[model samples]
Target: MNEADALVDGEPQFWGGCEIALNTEPLEVIKEILKACGGRLFEIGGVYKLYVGAPGLPVLTMDDGVLRADEAETAKPIRPLDERVNYISGSYTRPEDGWITRVGPPRFDASRISADGRVGADLDVPVVQSGKHFQRLQQQLLNNAAKERRHNLPLPPSAWGVEPGDVLQWTSEHNGYEDKLFEVEHVTDDHSLDSVAAVLEIDHDDYDFDPETDLIEEPDGVLDVDRPAPKEVGSFAVAGVANVGTNNTVRPAVSVSWDDPDDADVTAIRVAYRIAGQVDEPGYAFSYEPAAGQLLIVNLQPATNYEVKAQFESFNGWATETTPWLPVVTPDIRFSQNDFNAAVNARMAQLDTASQAAIATVRDALVNDLTNLAHYLLGQIAKLDDQDQAYQATQGAAVNVVSEEVVTEKQARAAAIQSVEAALDDAAASLIGQIAEVDDKHNALATLFGQVFAENGEGAASALFRLIAHAAPTGVAARIALEAKTAAGAYGEDSAALFLDVIAGVGSVATIKATAFRVQTATGFAPILEVQDDTVKIAGNIGVQGDALVDGSVTASKIAANAVTAEKIAAGAVQAGNIAAGAITANKIQAGTITADRIVTNGITQSDADSGSASGAANGTWRTLCTINIEKDSGTRGVMFLGIISGSLGGSTSQSAADIEGRILRGTSSALFQTSVVATIATGGAFTIPMSVGFRPGSVPNGNHTIRLQVRASIPGGVTIAASGYLYSMLPRA
Candidate 1:
């Protein structure tokens, strides 16, 4: 990457990592990375550059000479400002909990809504942690969304100097544009048209964001919702038509049937019903368990009209809206014979009146047609008679021929009248037969009514009503729909099909009690969740949040390998006795979990401790005594350089001293611990000087290091140093 690209690429500013799944498209991964940093990748002059936050400073100014004067007057917008994206929403990983939580754009008074209202786009920065960096990301995204106005500016060849991601200043009087700054999204050259146009969008900068002042609200969560309500009151209908209940006393009733609310929180349903127009009267109410298919509302007045509606109750509160009121009219207790007869008679009379009216209309229309035909025949006869008289005056023999023609025409008119009479007679016969058929049906209905309204209470109608309305006999219980069962099963209640069985509890709160709950997987059955009288066992993976308040000790064998992470254990919660011997190896101990003070002396193994002996003699110049190379793992630790130097101390002059030093070298840095042995005379048999050095390199880079003992004499007399050194490396707590 180029130096400039790397600077704006957010590598140093926002430190994070993302897990890339296999088979993920390279372009998608690149896009997500760029989005996480509020950056954009664009190609300029054959080279690709990734701009992290915003475009660079303005490169040039476009005025009359650089821009096409006439084209600028009709400059077209790349997209209407109102149609550009504004609101942003998406998911990001929360560092504290490692949960992928949804986040919305930061609130800013200057932010604008698109034409369609709250037009939004998702900016998923799943790798971002919940902190100031995440807020800054949101701020940058909002600022980018605010820069929605982009216009296509026609420019001269001189404007070609502006490249993509370059901000440019433009002054125009045509569209009332002042000395406004715009970033060049891209520039297009048309050789054929001899024109160059650049797409310029409003530019954003550091001035648009103020980390200290702007709001950095928490991410969207479940509790952030103001008040959630059910999406729907599912499957509502009124049942039990034409039914009467006589459990304690006879009364008309209807069953309110409905499914559970779509919302899982809704626990029960409340129904209210009263006479349709009795608003001032007290209404009856009934509460049904959640998902109860049906409930009978009894004690209603016979033949009375009522309206009922249902409302749902959730943990949050009651639903804001209720189901629309449904109207129902109770059936009368009895029907008298006189009343039934009168109803049938009234209906029959209506049919008779309609039939008579239709017949009269047809009779009038036929009479008028016959009258018009007679008038036309009369006029024709008079004209023919006049022609016959004129013919007699012209020729006496023709007068007898006219008389014979008139006689033959009169005979044909009589035959036509006979045919019409026969057709009218058939229509009358058909009407009479229909009337007789209707009378026969009416007589049959009267006979049935007699049987139904028989004097005694043991009529076929009463038997039929009881047979249909009363509950079925014991063995045929399956024929009727099963009643809904409750969490506490009640006696005399019918069986029900349950989606989930809650063994105990009242109302909405419930507990699932089971000796063993076996889950079936593709492999086989597994008792993933089991409940005992005082203990619970889970054979599969389980997640626990917050502090685990264990009353009893958790055995080592019960805990799975790697189940308890460094973060999961509280500081100082684990003691030496709590850990089994050899249970924790060097590899198992996290770098910062254990400190020097926390580790017991015996915690250091033989492999980590080393000792060596060296004998050397030197005069004036420093001489190497003993050297040991120790390999250090990448962890926070400290090492001690310890040794004992004993040898003859001799110098050219009396009171001269021999100096011994212990040095620890790692990379380019070293620490030294020095001690001296003084001789009263020029020579001495031997002396011992103990040198110990403690180097607490808090967190040094990992590699092999050398610790050595060196000796030197003050004067030119042989100085001998025999040294035994030891090196111990220890890890410290985080």
Candidate 2:
């Protein structure tokens, strides 16, 4: 086939231009060119080819009959079903600044983001210079990455010609897939089964992205928060008292007018004022308005001076520095309508007299100036007419002389060109001879280099062949030898610069015999790994096999939190000493695992306590002061009740004794488990009783028992009794 003719027929009709470095790899240049044009590079029939845009319409159908049923599952997803690739971010060359910049924000699919937020991808398209083009590429990549659903369809012998990158449509009611377009990503031919299987991916074109219509422009300018101050102030003054409120009340105010800042982002004008020479003491009065140009700083003191300034406020949270202070003083007194009228009339009378005098002076000057101009014009016109007549007589002779000079100049130009051509020919001959001589010298140098660099010869071994080695056998005088003959130097290397890429042959270990060995990074070289005695130490992370650790070798300090599982530790291996104090919280213990046996001796398994007042008890009748219910364990032995009761036996006559008693009762039964009679009141005076009672209900059922502290007075009239206390249920050691 004619190569040129084939290219014209097969290649794209449109032409495009690109720039690349001369020293760039051919494959890299090809890859960049393809990426810039939204194309893919592929190999077919042993020849590389380029295809642009999405694959063509489906040419094959993957219906139920074309799929294999033997496999347990046919439809699969390349990525997790919940993981979405909605956002695509990368860097591209910005044409405006000739620098690599982000392609605006990431191109995103809002629908996918709403469904699943794990959507992110980065695709570097360095060759794409236009921001719009870079945005389009990002959208395309996002769409491609979103096709996570894949299907492996096994086909019969009839479907043999399908290849990767071929577009196909699939319809499977079982998997709920309709007539969906899919791109073939991989194919495997089963020779034993006489069948072919293809891995198909959902095509990106179905997502729908148009480069021309759906483009996003790169944003520009400083952020709205960074807006600058307004450029100019129009006016700042103390206007006369005026009605400046909704009630039409008169008030002294300062008027400030400023030009709006040029920035479109400027959202408001901030005006501030302070008493003159007292800005730092009281600070400034700051107020902002949505509009610019003018503002009224009202409610100021009459006859007072103020220093006012204004600045700009952006829509976001940022304000410019205040402008220079503008000084203004309020009027001493409010000017009434009569005062304004009288002042205006006086100024008008003075201006009217001055205007009439100026008009008379202007009328006299015009008449004098017009007469002088007519005389000067008549004298100058006669002189110009005589000069024009003399010039007309000499015009013909001057034209003839100019024509002769043109012919003579043309003849001299032809002679100069002939001489220049002869000199150029001689120079060309000399240049060719010099070029030949240079070529001869270059060839001689090339031969010398070839001989010096030859692999096997009396010529020295080049640095290219053996990176660090002696060149020829001129001994130590000419070339440096790197081999360590006796390990004698301080660094242990035979040569000063023999430490890079040194190789010990198979069945031997290459040792870095220096105090430290460093690896190179972009910034410089630093030791990342070190050998200390029998152990290896790494500055960064190091991976080791699971079996590499010895039994019980990893201490608590070396272990990460939650790194050790139950399977990792042998049963009964963890002792009490191995656990840290408070390391095991209530949530860490499994429910129902802390039985009564696990509790310590005299643990006080359950307790309930309350403190309150009690009163309104009839003589010889009990009033419950506080009640506590304990759902104790079977091993609970007894409960302890302790508190103080203090109150006056009121309604008792002088010298009349009143007996008071405190008792602890179980449930609502009248039988008292414990009782004390320690209060004796001689009169209606105040009395204090210290009550400490303990109860042991020998045969009481274990679950949920109510205990109460009741107090009563043995006086004739109803006596008041008040108490406060606590209840504790203790368990004995097993």
Candidate 3:
């Protein structure tokens, strides 16, 4: 047989191995021969050959309608039958398992098999090392098995040759047969005289194949088969509007809810919002996952309407259509500007009323005092007139008598008249001085009250007027009245001037009141007079008619010596400046309530404690360390001294110590009280001794007395005193 036929016949000569007669089929026998040669069998040019490491063979491609075979001869074309296989499936034997066991898990193209049946179930006899490699091999085998037609083409006699592992390409003029490429499975050449041509069996290479490298390139533009398709976005809507804060410029947040597309390709939703009429403001935008379909849009204008929109994105660079713009409005903010103005106006009006009432009270008090003074002066003048009339009558009778004795009597009467006139003149002078004093007081009060309510250029009246204008936009009458009142300094200066004129005897009280208000009657206008009676009554009722008057209108000069009793003064009205030095005796002060705070200086104050320190004494001796001088007035009934004495006493020997004593003494001589003796033996070794003493020295005489803390140790090596010792005295309440 020829060499190609001999190889196909499983000849032992082709492979250097011991071969016995094969009882298997022809294909099986050929496979056995190839296995023995450590190669695979391939059929080419109607002959079978052994192809060792076929995957590692150089690939060939068509060049100018010719096969550019690598390390092989040129390629030739053959007519292929239009045989189509509907289904392609593959199976492989696991290399780890024995050759008898096949891979149980089968892999196949379901769509292809459904249409083509099991005709394409092909066994891929590749020794796959792993399931993954097996799968790849199966895929390739399945693709190859699904080819429509495969042919064994005879090579032209003019060509050098072709090998089983070479690749070839050519075009066929046959109907439906166009340009095609193939891989030469096997090549064969017969050397006998009758055999002239070499034949090649080829499989379709529908995919790009690089023969020189034996690698397949996937078809151009093929997508990543593992990726999923893009999904369309679903509808979204605004949930509700959240309450915005009260600030005008504060941003608001709107809540939104939507359904997730549930698509693998959908990564997130793009959300954006803008105010309804302010689209140009370039509002906010954000992105969120489809799973979290809800979003909060923030930094929006308060009390403003807004529109929101959403869209979905996909893996394939596709964006779904945006959802419709949803309408939403932030909550309305409260506290408008007008409301604030109204509140301010009401407050100012209340304050203005109070200030007016205070001024009226002072004015009326001064007027009442002036009226009382007027009545007194008038009655005194009337008394002087009666005395003058009586003297005139007496003088006339003396003149008519005309004798020596009568003359003498007349001279005596004249002398008496002179004395009486002198007394009257003195009385008049005193009344004039009082009138001047009252006038000064009235001027001083007027200046003070003027400063209190109307001096700062923004007086109570001016402020009230402005507030009234803002509060009552349409109340012209009210606004005009406030304006007029403010212009007149809230009637403060006018009232003060009028009262001053009346008290200075420039005008009568009735005339002054009428002239100030331009009233025809003695009584003032209702608004001015309504408060007059109440305030005048307050002044008039200050003291009983028989009692000496003590009121705000009464100056210090007018008060009699020692007239201001405790019952006559209000609590807290007696300030420090009002009382003379040493005036507040113990009787004047509530006992025990005279705290250290009441004494300004030279008392046991906080600073005294800070500046003082504890002192120690030697054995059998007393040390007068801290001395406090307490001021007691005449009526003081009880005095108490309290403090703590802290120190440590050491004895030279254990049994050499007696006791340490702390005593509180009053004045220079009296030992008011003492703490119980603390045994010095107990404090022998680096220990502290604390003694607390509270002493009441009965009723201390009314004078400045010295109080002392005396410490004595019976026996001591050395005594160390802590610096926390302090003492103070207080008056016990009666």
Considering TM-score, which of the candidate structures 1 and 3 is the better prediction for this target? 1
Taking the tens digit of each residue's C-alpha lDDT, what string does model 2 give over 1-734? 12112222234322233567799899888777776666655564476655556566777877777765565446666677545578777776654553535456677888888878756877676666556556656766677667677777777677776766678887878777788887766567766454444555656554354545686666753323334444443443334344354333356777777654556556666676788888364433343543446777777788898887766666655545557877788756564565656665564554345333323332233223223322333334445545644654568777466756645654554444334333333322221100001122122110000001111112212211111222222221111123222223322333222323423233323334433444422223554456556555565445454457787677789989866554334334455776779989899865676555443354544556654567764467777777777765556654444434445555554423346666667776554355554553423344444444444435455677677776777665554554443333333211
Off by over 4 Å in 1: 1-15, 69-82, 99-116, 190-195, 205-207, 219-734
Candidate with top TM-score is 1
Which pairs of residues collide in candidate 2?
none
How many pairs collide in each candidate, listed in order? 5, 0, 7
Indicate the residue-level lDDT of 143 in model 2.
71
For model 3, the run of ten residues with the poorest summed lDDT: 432-441
| lDDT of candidate 1 over 1-734, digit per residue (tens) | 24223432233445455789999999898877776677668886688977765566678876545666566434445446544556655656754554546464544323456334665666667766545556667666666655545677677666656567778787767556677887767777776443444555665564254545664556444434355544455677775354532232244677788775556677667788878877775465666466665777876677778888877767666445688888888766554465467666676775456445434433343344334433444454556657756766787666567868765664554454444434333322222100111433322110000000111122111100000011122211111111233324431342232122212222222223333434433334665556567767777556452247474556779779878875444345567776679978989777887666443343342224344556555444545555566655544344444343334443322333334333433333334333332321212333334334444444444566655555554433564544443333333321
Query: What is the RMSD of candidate 1?
Result: 56.2
**In candidate 3, what are the lDDT values of residues 566-585, reduced to their tens digit?**
44443344577765699768
* TM-score preference between candidates 1 and 2, better one: 1
Alpha-carbon error at 381 in model 3, in Å?
99
Q: Candidate 1, after superposition: displacement of residue 197 in Å?
A: 3.2
Clash pairs, candidate 3, are 44-186, 45-199, 45-200, 58-211, 59-211, 59-212, 60-211
The total number of steric clashes, by the backbone 3 Å criterion, in model 3 comes to: 7
